[model samples]
Target: MKESFNKNDYGFWNSPFQAKDLASKSISFTDLFIDNGVVYWGESRPDEKGRNVIVSMHPDGSIQDETPPEFSVGTMVHGYGGGAFLVKENQLYFANSKDGMVYHKNLNTKEINPVTFPFEGRFADFSLDSKRKFLYCLRKNDSTQNQFPPTEIVRINLVTKETEVLFTGSDFYSNPSVSPDGKKLCWLQWNHPNMPWDNNELFVADISSENIITNSKKILNSSVGACYQPIWSPKNELFVTFDGNNYWNIYKIVNDSFEIILEKKSDFGRPMWISGTRTFSFLQEDILIVTFCDNGMWKTGKIYLKNNGFVEINNNLSTIYNIAADNNQFVMFAGNSLLALAVVSSNIKEPFKFKILRKSLDDSFPSNYISEPKEIEFTARDNKSVYAFYYPPFNPEYLKDENNLPPLIVKIHGGPTANVDCLMNPKIQYYTSRGFAYLEVNYRGSTGFGRSYREELKGKWGIKDVEDCLDAVKYLIQKNLVNKDKVILAGSSSGGYTLLSTLVKNNKFLCASCTYGIADLIAMTEHIHKFEAYYDQSLIGGSILTDKELYFNRSPINSANEIKTPIIFFHGDKDPVVNVKQTEKIATALKENNIYHEVYIFSGEGHGFKKAESIVKVLDKELKFFQKYLSN
Candidate 1:
């Protein structure tokens, strides 16, 4: 292990974790589950042009890629897809990214067949009926002219090879969890003007012998708050996480009333950004293996239904994703700041004893070369508390002058609704290992915190989020931890909005990088996808019609003349969200204003860069841009 700290190390130390490792070697695992003693997950390979391959691990610890190279296991449902695949009785069903059709693969025979015809729409959040004769999922129809599409819970008859719409009325539907006995069906639904995390309803219906859904009734209406992950227990009981008391807690629907199963100050549920996100799984009829966010860190535990008691499972992992119960054990993808993301499993009784099935980064670096983050809470401009993770410069091999301070990199996470955790992110480590002081600001509006804090950015979108980012830098500079003149701003998506807004509002940083970020809120509202059509309305105070001035005024593109800091923008020409034109328009305005700026449009890339070459180019250019500006 390399020594963790050496105050003598220079500020611009060299790191072995180069941009190549970050782009090509650091793998990302998502949508994990287990079936019939086999662990399965969606592995994204940058080297393969960001192809998502379905991988499976057998009981004997044998691993193999299940999907063929031509077939990438992904979907475009709701624009941001998840729950792309499911397995049953050796039959693998997955949505193909190329055609938006669901495919079936016989694990035994390795024969691939298309289950659904090619269409403009997509299918996700897959669920199978009791007899496996029908597949249930949320089917999104994108042919509509409206930005928001008409989504329905549909059942596909496997024997007949036909699709049947089971339920339709809501603007969006997800999490179609059939009862273990197959007699009842439960799912979540929310309409326009309200995002899933803002407000949604949970419904349950009786399933007829003929496979028709009837007697549909709302079981829980989150009119005041939000609800997520409605799942059925082994004994046919229904449970979900509700954020009625500011914090998302586990609740059980009993006699038409929600009974708190476990109450905590932390959030048991996260923002419903994608489909098929599972935070908890039933290990048995009365036990649940779960993960929750506590103070920005995700922790796993066991919940006893009968006693409403909980026991913290000491798995060293601070970030856990896509958990599924497998017999008496649970399998998941999890890792912390110092650990690489891996496919891990543990017995319900001994949940801490993790068995690593696979690792994204197989090779480990010297301990001293890594810089660990320290969680910090600072007061915002409004006196509200803002949380961030601070990582100081660390390089054991080099030494720096005692009087000098390191340059700062303020990383703002996207989502505006999402929060960052202590994950082993190769991207963050890429800069920190090179002696940059990194800070990830969990601004108000970010999840993981209580509902009140998360809602603070509502109606204040660009304003408060921008304030928090600026406040974080001011706090660091006041503490003498970072040089104010050498600070760099970086963010993507909504975070990019905050970055550009900050640069326009104040000139506290040297240079900044924006990736597929929003520059014109007005244009974004017009080009926004169906899933988040109304997201800006809630965040920015009102719709385009109601608050047109606010939209134009909050947009960074409108105030490009106010920006003096140099910036480099990376955007995907085919991005569905935050149209590439947003970046182009802003760059044009900057050019007219004679402000230093550059824009790189990558071909075939989208909201997030997936190709290794694109990732490498962005990082390489960003490093040089920041270094050049810092030196000046």
Candidate 2:
């Protein structure tokens, strides 16, 4: 019998959505907490109203009903106001997004009560100083002005209903970890013009009996690079992971001095900012089990603090989002073939048992049929090393001619700073299975490599990222893995900007496609979300008025005359990040220039393609466009 693959298997299957269209699905891990001998994890489900819901899952692989508490409505979905649930004894305390208030829920009584605090801000984490009866939280001030200072740390007395500001600044603050003894508080902070990966400071403060912050000292600030994801050792000694000197390494504070624990060129931290959660699991003994992503694959390893060595435990998992450990056992949310819990002995020896919680894909697409991506490193124009995942063309039904290598689609990930990992991305598979080789580029400014490499595209966003894509294409052609004449460039958001810039800068690409991409830097800077309003300051430089020529030089819309490749553009009418007007202006220019181009706009979608129908349509249109232009 022939194996069958269902392309339209759309529903919330794995985390909340099916694996085939996971790329477009709005899924995130939330409410990871230990409760009643089981670990509970909450996830956001897709809904028309964009209501943020949390799904509770047990460590033994049991999922509870999708809980959409009354507070989820009208909350920001993209990294905004969703509360992190914390269960203490029989009661649960979590922040309510609806009113920007913190609430407590009784698991035993099923009763919910609002904690008396009048504040209009998003609350992230809460650390209870049990001895002093104080709750420390990282709160983002929701003052609606044209601009304001960054987020701050606050402390609240649960009994008195009194709130006190612990720390305030222009620097963004997050991940407040109170020491095991509740004597010292540790947190991470990063300033403007630099994201967390660019530069950050680790601070430790003495917690007074009155819940006041005292003797706050910068424990670890990156002199050469940035420090992030500070995790305190069980003994209350400061342990932090930082990319100092262009390499991510683990360091411990001993006698107020830094001691290198584990050093590697690979990344222990993810590309994005770290949530207030544990990355490393402390076992029964002194075994430090941590998950790290190298190249693109994620591995769970055990680090011996005494000998300063790490041994890989599970090498098959693509990404381990979270890890939890108890006395004699350990559990982790391991990703790859499935999102499941890996139960193992505290020693981490012998066979581990995996309880599958979520399976993204069906069994129809077997391992042999799936395309395996190979890591490729090439030199860019500045001799900088660029990393990319090259997925070779593979289709059981398709027969290929000897001379006809598969068409290539070069994918530029958004954030330009975000590095594409080896996740089981069906978006890439959708093209690869149809005989298109896909290359996802982690160009300069992409995190995971280190600070120096990430800052390589600081003032050269359009130029450097474009060059990296071109260089990757050249490398593939030289390796004979892809057809040089049939190479197309594709990206969304920042990647979309890179795609457009590549089309204008070079004529090598036969076609270019972008979704909600920026065409004008000036327009983007003028009208952008508050989270990244000053993004251009770090990306391209000052305002268009201050650096007029630089803005024009970086914007593909200004250099559209140089673009000879046929372009396809997709934008959402509701996209506030990269406004649809950017695409409209470019489409108008394309029409005036008589450049063969097409633009598609989704009515209510935002920066990303959200709706299932919209996602399928975009994929279909993109594939058809490439086939029409490149294949012929």
Candidate 3:
């Protein structure tokens, strides 16, 4: 199976992975749950206008779309929605995006009915407690108050449809889990100036026999860094993930003290951007199943709590989500070595067979054309260490020219709070296969490293992110690995903003390509959604009210005149996060200054381009734009 390496000029520009091949007809799984030998998840179908529906596996092993065409089982709460549906005893409870009402569906009868009154409010991060006859959830509570929003944790009676506020006074609340006996409630709480990742508290409350919370106390505080996914064992032991020293690790509360279950540099928890995120589950309180990220590679493992030992479950699986255990078998949606996936459930015992229940994609792509990224670590301009993934250009038939260097396309990931994992991304491969050496920078402030490293760009967003990205490509050029003259910058959302920011500060790159990126920090803070309203406050050191000059100084629009290269921008007209007007303003500025730039707006797209046509067009246009500049 070994083949020869291509020796043609780098950036050869011809490969098997083309723009036309970008359309993936297969479904992508998200936020799945497993119960009683049945698995249910949301299927993101790009070909269906980016429509998302609940999908479930039948008893006969057939897969069916559970949510009808008229209903989209999604939530708008927190802007980024997940854990939108809960299943109990063959009944599905979900809040549809169309009506913002919780709907109940009988899985056996295939009949659906509205459970909550039709309203403009949104709900997410739900849990069903059949014993209390209540569905606990985190709601935005627009129907109550907004100017001083209190993160409302409400319980809806499944029978009477009456909503009662269980807890309030915290700026944010999530993951309201009820104990099996329905006598205790545990949830996550964090005030403003701190996101769930920055700092959060785990609160446990005693519930009365009448379904009332009598007393509550914070079991874990902000000194813990951040806490997530507070759940109780069958024996009523409190379990949570906490970042005590530098990494997110699991611990159990026993006799009012923390008992470390597992500790490592890896992250057992991710940022709680959306609700209902879990990285580990306690099976019967003795056997623990965990998924952790070691340098952006996700792996599932089984931990023996007694010996404090662990064994990795599957090595080839890249990304695993929605891990739940049923008896001796665990089911989860996982991406395999081929970058395609299915609902896989495997027995915990070794030598047990791994069964693929339902497949999401079956492209059967040739192995020769796929280029896997290698982890790269280098010193930044600040003399600090930085991490990124370097993907070398590859082609089975064409050889790179020894004298010509490969073009570099540096990607800046959004969230800047989030890190890019080592998963096989077709989008990056589409360019890498065609001769572009890609580098995905997990710049300062990006998570997955330790806490200090992630908060390095706390008040230095534009400065640190831009520095890390430039240093990455500079490191490549100094090492004679890539063509310095043809380097390009690309990112989406915050990454897009950094992409544009890089262009403003440096002129070495050929052009900048951004999708729905931030052009004005001031504008973004003013109009950004509720979930991220305080984002710039933390990223920019403070809000405009506190740091007016820095806000203006950090925005890309202030330095738009300094751009020395062409730029191409993409925006979805329907994007609610960063308004389309932000993109339009930048486009108008480019015209006024006579700077070379092109702007293409999609009619029905949002913050992220999800539609097949939008994705295909963006890829094609960006490719053409880069090619035009490289030739010049």
Candidate 4:
């Protein structure tokens, strides 16, 4: 008789109605729009205005609310800076980075108008080309202007409010699409030593009719892989989704060659970059539905092209987030582990019709204190295979007995080629409910398996993600489920540079933590940020003045006097991506090599950790620094 889920039985363990009250008791579906005959989504309501207001559901069903603007006191920075509606002809157009302006409602006179651009940036993809009267937009520049440059691809002129700069990116620009006679303009670029699923570039241009940008082309660059979402097929052809031979398939561009149309092993990009959405949804005239990433969930299928086949239509959707379609219906933003909205109808025996619009919390936590992860698969030291999630410590209020077995940690996910899924992250359930047993590790340069396992971490980033995170901590202490002297190891920026290069080149991490990570890969290729300033020429290859000893032998503060574990860190004194002097030069080389380390810093935060008492004081100071050195 042990059953107790607390924090008001279920609401406050880092609330937001805990993934919409676990997606309304697990039926799931939310925020996936298409207006009028109804479909509009965004939900997560338990009050204090963290998320909610914006709901609709018709198509002979009937349901409409749209209740935003309430929880005042800086309402979570104005509902996390709202705006992203765009429903043409019925007029909606949105992008109110909390009144930075670009509004225009009407849905039949619900009335609202705002538009007055001068660019304070962050309004991605809007198009009204209406035969070039112009209104094209796609701005991002998250300016703090340390000498201006972060991301851009502008265009605005709803009849001369004028603003141009068709392309100006040192890295990052996404899904611009446009071209059903808009005179061509595709997008999607990546730089930063790489991460857009590890490599990206699709780009296309030639517009001018006074919208400018008359010639530009890079149409698909690959030096071995990574290309991303760049759609444009309604008979204009020019689709894309690369990771060529390592698996993320779907390519088109006929006559000029580049053909594969849907190969698979999973992942179709999207772990970041939302807004200006579109995951292959052409709908009719020979159908094509697309959305991929299989094992780490999120799936959607249906690409017939007269029988080239692939009919998956939804395989237990898990936090889809967006996908819209026409030719008779299809609107998802799905959910199963909470996050909602689903509707499907192309008559393939219709039945999917959900509408949970945000549940925000009710079951009061206690599926044994929430810890359900298991995807595991190991192999790596170049033998390859690697993929992980693990998690294990079922917390009956943090109890453990039958011969104790918990202390583990590991983690490492910061685009060391990202891939940690099964969303609902209470910061990884506040450390397996407190007994602790995590893992995460999607090593081998992670990115949903394909493209030769993301080029096996090219020239091996800090030696293949620190030898596949020490062979997943020696396959979890040889399956004893962790306890080989309480192993630890965490990560942040580049998984905090592979947790200080695996505790200064392994002795089996008995301690290590990081955030705003990276400790000098030649001073992060001379001051990071310029979209990864040529990411050490593709993961540490040379040019720290031509590979200064492979950037000081793959920096961990140049082997911090060969560490010896105990490291903990966390930064953010305005961290513009891994720089708080890379954790104060590894806390001054763990205090001139006498070793034992710990550092904090936050103030005004940046590079991750946005308020809410700095994410509950950085997860309660990394759970009291892993219970002061793994509990003993």
Top candidate, metric TM-score: 1
What's the lDDT for all of these models?
Answer: 0.86, 0.68, 0.79, 0.63
Segments in model 4 whose C-alpha atoms lie over 4 Å from true places: 1-86, 89-124, 129-368, 371-394, 397-405, 410-484, 490-493, 505-530, 535-543, 546-550, 556-632
The candidate that achieves the highest lDDT relative to the unseen native structure: 1
lDDT: the better of candidates 3 and 4: 3
Model 1: pairs clashing at backbone N, Cα or C within 3 Å: 8-399, 8-400, 9-398, 9-399, 9-400, 10-399, 10-400
Q: What digit string (tens of lDDT, one per residue) describes model 4 on residues 1-632?
A: 23433322221223222333332333222335564446665443323222334556666667665534631111111012222445555555556535444555566777665555644555645655556645555555545555434566666666566666678744666666677778888776766656566667676787877656767767644446666666676676677767657676777766444677767778665533244455666676567777777656667777887665887764565546567665446666555433223343332345244444343334464444666677788776667678787877655543344465667788888866567766555556666665667888788766656566666677778888888888888888888887777777788888888777877777656677788888888777667655456656677766776668888877878778888777778887977656788789888988987877778898867676544455556666666676776534
Candidate 1's C-alpha runs over 4 A off are 1-11, 130-132, 143-147, 221-223
Look at candidate 1 and tell me the lDDT of residue 10. Answer: 29
TM of each candidate vs. truth: 0.96, 0.86, 0.94, 0.31
lDDT of prediction 1: 0.86
lDDT of 3 by residue, 407-513 (tens): 88998999879988776677777788778899999888987777888889998988899999988988899989898888898888999888878988898888879
Kindly list the per-residue Cα lDDT of model 2 for residues 1-632, writing each as its tens digit: 22432322111011212333443343445545554555555554443334455445555566664344566622331243332655545556676656877666666776777654777666766676656766777776766432543477888777787777878864577678788788899887767666666667778888777656789887744356666567666677777777775666777877655677887767777543335445675663467778776765667777887787777775467666666665545556565633222322223553144455543343344455466778788988778788988887765654444645667888899987777877666666667666678888888888667667777888888888888888889998888877777888888998989888888878877788988888998888777765566668788856666888788778889988888888899998998678899999888888888989999998888876656667667877887788777535
Cα lDDT tens digits for candidate 1, 1-632: 33343432423467887888778777877688788888889989999998999999998988999998999888877888788998867888899888888988988999998887666788999888738578889888766655577888888877777888888888888899888889999888889889898888888999988766789898754447788899988789999999998889999999876888988998899888878788999888898999999879999989988898899988899988778996787898888888768888888768888998988874755555778888899999889899999988766665544567888899999998999888767777778777788999999999898899999999999899999988999999999898787889999999999999998999867899999899999899889887888889889998899789999998998888899988999999999988999989999998999989888999999988899999999999998888777656
**Model 1 / residue 473 / CA error / Å:** 1.1
Model 3 ranges off by over 4 Å:
1-21, 24-26, 58-60, 144-150, 340-342, 351-365
